[model samples]
Target: MAELEPEARDRIMDVFMARYNALHATDYDRFEDGPKGTDHDYLCVSSSGKAPLKVQHTRAWADPETEWRVPKDVERLIVHALQRRLDERKICDRHVSIRVDSFPPKRREKLALLEKIWMAVEFGLNRDWSNPSLQRLMRYERNDWTQFYQPISPYVAELEILERVPPVQAPALVGWSATGEEGDGVQDAVFRTVEALKKKEEHYRGTSADLVLVIDFEVMPYFQDELERIRAALAARSIDFREVWLVSQWLPVSADQVWPAPNVQSADAP
Candidate 1:
C-alpha cells in the first residue's frame, strides 16, 4: 500500500468530517494539519468554538504486509514492462487495463510474472472477438471495449481491451486493483480494526484532545457486519478514543460511527 499524499489525505479527512458533522449534528468546519512528528494527524475545529478534536487516520489492510510490499510499485512495474514490450513489438492497436490477481513474493518470481502477463495480453489480442459470447461482454457505448477474463495466466486476472475506436500514440495499461487478493470477510475486518486501534492507543496515550480514529476502508472491503463486529471488539477492550469511524473510499462515500456501542454506553457518552 502507498502512503496517501498530503492532498489526498486532507481530502479524505474533509469527506469524513462532512459525514461526521451531518450524522452527529456538530458544526466541525475547519481543519489544520497536526504538527509534524505529533501524535495526531489533524486538528478539527467546530463553528461553535468547541475544543479542537485531535484526529488520527489509520487504514485497515486485509493483508497488513502490504505496507512493506507496496502493491502500487508492483502495478507500476507491470505497466512499464508491458508498455515497453508493446513499443518493442510496435503493436499500438488498442488500450488495455489489467487487474492483477497475485504477484509472486520473490524477486526472481516477479520477473517471470511480467512475462506471463505479456503472454496473456498477446493471447487476448489474438482472441476471436466476433464470437457471440465475447461480443456480449463488449461495451458498445464505451468505444467497443471488450473484457477478457483471466486468460490462463496466474498473474493477469482480468484484461479490458478496447479496439476500433481511435488510434493513440501509445497503447496504455490504465488500471489495477489496489491489492489483488479478495477480502477475508468480517472477521478479518474486526481483526484489522482492533489491531489499528491498539496500535494507536499505545502511541497516543494521555493526549489531551478528543481522538477520532478514522479506519480507512480503501484497501479493505467494507461490510455492514464489520460495524457490529468492531463495536463488539471495542466493548471488550479498554481503548482511549472519543469516537471511532469507518470511512469508505468508494463513491456515495460514507463515514460510519463504530464506537460508543449502543448496548455498552461509555461513562463519557453525552
Candidate 2:
C-alpha cells in the first residue's frame, strides 16, 4: 500500500473527528499533525479542554493489490460523456442507469464504447413500433421511460432509462459495476481489520496519549455482525490502542466503535 500524503492524511482525520464527535457526543474540535518521527499520526484536541488524544489512522483493503485495478476516474469519464450527450439531445426529463460488465483498458476503445451507447439510446428513444399487433401490446405495457439492452461491446453491457418522479432540472446518469468478490465478505473484512491492528500496534506502543485505530471500510462489504466478529478477534489479541473505530466513506457515511467491548459493563454501573 502507498503511504498517505500529509494533506490526504489530515483530510481523513478531519472526517473521522467529525463522525467521532457525533457518535460519542464529544466536543473534539480539531487536530494537528504530530511531530516528525512520532509514533502517532495526529494530536486531536477537544474544545471542552479535555486531554488531547494521539490518533493513528490506517486503511484496510480486502485485496490491496486490486484496489485500484479499475480507476475511478475512468468511471467518472463515462458518466460525464453520457451526460453531455444527454444534454445535446435535450434529454432533461429523466435519469439513466448503466450496468457495466467490464471496461476496456485502452482510452480509444472506451470512447468508442461510449459513442455506441449514446447512439443506441438515441435510436431506442425514436424508434416507432408501428405494427398494429405490437402497438396493441405496447399500450398494455406502457411505461414512463424506455429501456434498452445495448451489447455495445464486451465492456459496456446494459443501459436503462428511468422516469424522474417529480421531474428534474436536468437528466442525470448513475453508473455502477459489480466489483466485489463473491462471498459474505465477513471473513475478508475481519482479516483486513486484524492485519491493520497488528501493524499499527508496534508504532503506537508505549505512547502517552490514547491510541486510536481507524479502519476504512469504504470498499470492503460488511454488516453489523461483521463488526461483532472483528471486535471479538481484536479483543482476543493484546494490543496498545485504547479504542478501535470502523469508518465508511461512502454515502450514508458511518463511524462505529468496535473496541473496548461495548457489552462489558463497568463494575460501578447501576
Candidate 3:
C-alpha cells in the first residue's frame, strides 16, 4: 500500500528489521528518543563500527515533505540534536543511528546542498534562518551532516550518525532511497544516488571511497536500469561507492544490484 497508517508502518519496519537481523544477527529495539521533534520507528548502535546497526531503514524512500516542507524551527531542532551527538565522544565511539520508515523524497542532492550553502550564507550575513542554534549547526556540519529535515515544511527522514571510522579517515554517513516509483522510475534513483555522491564529494574532497549507498529492489523491474544509471552517476562524478548491496530480501520482492547479489548464506547455512 502507498500510504500506511503509523501502526502498520511500524509493523512493516519490524518485519524488515527481522530480515536484517536474520542475515546479520542484530539486537534491534524501538527507537523512542528521537531528535526531539521528529519521529522514528526503530534504532540500533554498535561500538565496533563493523556492520553497526544504522537507525535508518533499508527499504524504499518516502518523503514526508513532498507537499509540506519542514519548517525552519523544526529543522534547527533536528540539527541541534545531531550536532550534539556529533560532539559527544561517547555516542561517536558507541556508533549510533536513528531510523525513519517514512518521509518525503529528498530534494535533489545538488539542490538540497545548495540550499544548505544558502542557509549558511544567511547566517554568515545575518539574514533569514539566522537562529543561534543554526550557528552551532554550522559549526559541526562536517562532523555530522545529515538530511533529517528540509527547511520550510516538516517531512520525516533518516537521522543517521557519522561516527568517525578511524583516526586517519573520518566516518561518513549515507542516506538512500531505493523506492523506484518515488522518482518516476530509474531517473530518480540516478538523482538520489548522485545526490549522495555529491554530498560525499563535497565532504570528502574528491576521495570518497568510504562512502556507500545501499539500494534495494523496491521497483524490481528497473533494477538493471537503475544500477546502470547509478554507475553512470558515479562515473560522472569520478567517484565510487564502498559497496552497493541488493536489499531485496527485506523488501516486498527480491532483486540484486544488477541481478541477484549472492544470497550465499542459507537460513541454516551458518
Question: TM-scores of the models, in the given order?
Answer: 0.66, 0.59, 0.28
TM-score for model 1? 0.66
lDDT of 2 by residue, 1-270 (tens): 245666656556667777666656677898887787776667889978988877777777655433544535346657777777777767755556565545677778877777777776566445455652331111101123334333464444445555444556665554555243246233477888887776666555556236777776656534556777877898898766778877665544556677766553211101
For model 1, the stretches where C-alpha displacement exceeds 4 angstroms are 1-3, 23-25, 67-70, 87-175, 178-188, 205-209, 221-226, 262-270
Candidate 1 lDDT tens digits, 1-270? 135787667667878777676666678898988888776778888878977878888877645655425466566677778777777777655666766555677877777777766765776566666643342222211223334323325555456666533445554444555344344223377887887777777777756237788888776455665577778888888667888877776664556778865443211111
Could you give candidate 3's per-residue lDDT for residues 1-270 as a string of tens digits? 123356644544454445455554655544322243222223343344444343322334333232113332333434444444345432222222232222334446424543443343234233334443332222212224444234412222333222232323333222323121244333455554444344434644644344223343242323444666555455555444443333433324333332122253312111
Any idea what lDDT model 1 has? Answer: 0.64
Native-to-model Cα distance after best TM-score fit, residue 180 in candidate 1, in Å: 4.9
lDDT of 1 at 50: 79
Q: State which candidate, 1 or 2, has the greater TM-score.
A: 1
* Model 2 misplacement above 4 A: 1-29, 33-41, 46-51, 63-71, 92-94, 130-153, 162-192, 195-211, 219-225, 236-242, 249-254, 260-270
Model 3: runs farther than 4 Å from truth? 1-5, 8-12, 27-42, 45-52, 57-186, 196-270
Q: Compare the candidates by TM-score and give the number of the best one.
A: 1
